[model samples]
Target: MPNTQQLQDLTTQVRRDILRMVHKVNSGHPGGSLGCAEFFVSLYQNIMDRKETFDMDGIGEDLFFLSNGHISPVFYSVLARSGYFPVNELNTFRLINSRLQGHPTTHEGLPGVRVASGSLGQGFSVALGAAETKKLNHDKHLVYSLHGDGELQEGQNWEGIMYAAANNIDNIISTIDLNGQQIDGATDDVLPMGSLRAKFEAFGWTVVDIEQGNDIDAILTGMAEAKALTGKGKPVCVLLKTVMGNGVDFMMHTHAWHGKAPNDEQLEIGLAQNPETLGDY
Candidate 1:
């Protein structure tokens, strides 16, 4: 297992990968990708007990689904750097016939992806089904999923949340990236779903809050708490409060970069802020 410093270094590199990948394609979502870099690094490197090899069924191994799949840049970067595929393959992002599409697709045989997301409000349903399947098969491993705060505006997510609690799907932990920014503008300005904590509790799910979602140690600690809350009869929800475009000074706290790629000069500035922690793809 990697220590805290190593995970932090990998997070910085993941941020760089997000910037470069989107900049090259001249299109893609970077704000949420950057905000959730630390969470991805911490989950893949330290939290989930993944197998050495990849498979679709994933029996006896923890599985992850990206509900908000537009952040494929960060997911692709972290998966590649974590050895799911060759790091150089990142260059093909959003290209014609590339496995690394704008949103993750399973039909293309992407190693780490298991669902076709980005349609919003469906990932939680898929994850609950997986969690229930694990129980049916007697597999003790967990199912994990991530959702965007803005994505929760979709009505299907609420049904999935209600279903998970009703069915006692305790082995899954679904995290919401509470970054406050989405494509149009701030989530509040768009459509505020007030008090996510209270809502989750009302739905009969256990909720854990990582107040400092961008910090590596805070994420690790909060996830540990979430893991501890599993299997007692309710699903777990982690409210990860992160800053959109966290590492880049100009991009922080703004929705302007939600799905916009930085220009040459902006890319240079973003890269300079993160520095080359591990070699770039």
Candidate 2:
């Protein structure tokens, strides 16, 4: 039962974490990470039914996978701030021997991360497998995952989509970060994915549109609607539209910040915009 204001504070703090972690290491993806701040905040804090303790084989609770692991800053920040691990650990991001890598790795034994992502286009299938197992064991909890819209360029995702529809894997809710930008350039300029909604529906999924992916309230409502659409004999997909570099003014509408760390001066500007909501880690 997290209140809206508390969620906002956490979202601000997560943005702060994303900016600072990258600034320290002079590497990591910040654009998509910043864009997904509210979605991760709302999901971990209020949307998903999670256990107090972390477990590898999440048998009786909801599970989440990060198909687009390059945005580990936002995921790590929200997971740490939500009590999955110590918030201070974010300081070690991307350093040698640190559990926090550029992309999440299960080998590090990080409590919140479930898979080794960043290869792209593999998460939807992983989530579908988890969802199917929940049914095999008669567990009612759901499986949630996030995929970058640009990552859909991988061919394996199409196979995963076809499998889910043919088998009616209705317990998984996968959201695509429809920011329309990727590392190389704008998605359209790089490898255009026309009509994500129509594509998903054609693949036999119940699709929902979250026009404001950066807004906490909109994400909560849209995700709840997506959850409601589950268990009705169809898989669910949410087309989450967002602006890259969402919180920081200079970074907002461009792809330049996709995987670049901010300089000291830029860090100051970014931090100034977010302010210290729940105190920086």
Give the alpha carbon lDDT tens digit for every residue of 46-140 in model 2.
99999989998898999999999999999999999989899999999999999998899899899988889989999988999989899999999
Clashes of each: 0, 0
**Which structure among the candidates has the greatest lDDT?**
1
Q: Alpha carbon lDDT of residue 126, candidate 2?
A: 91
Model 2, C-alpha of 168: deviation from truth (Å): 0.4
lDDT of 1 by residue, 140-190 (tens): 999999999999999999999999999899999999999998888989999
In model 2, state the lDDT of residue 270. Answer: 98
Clashing pairs in 2: none
Clashing pairs in 1: none
| Segments in model 1 whose C-alpha atoms lie over 4 Å from true places | none
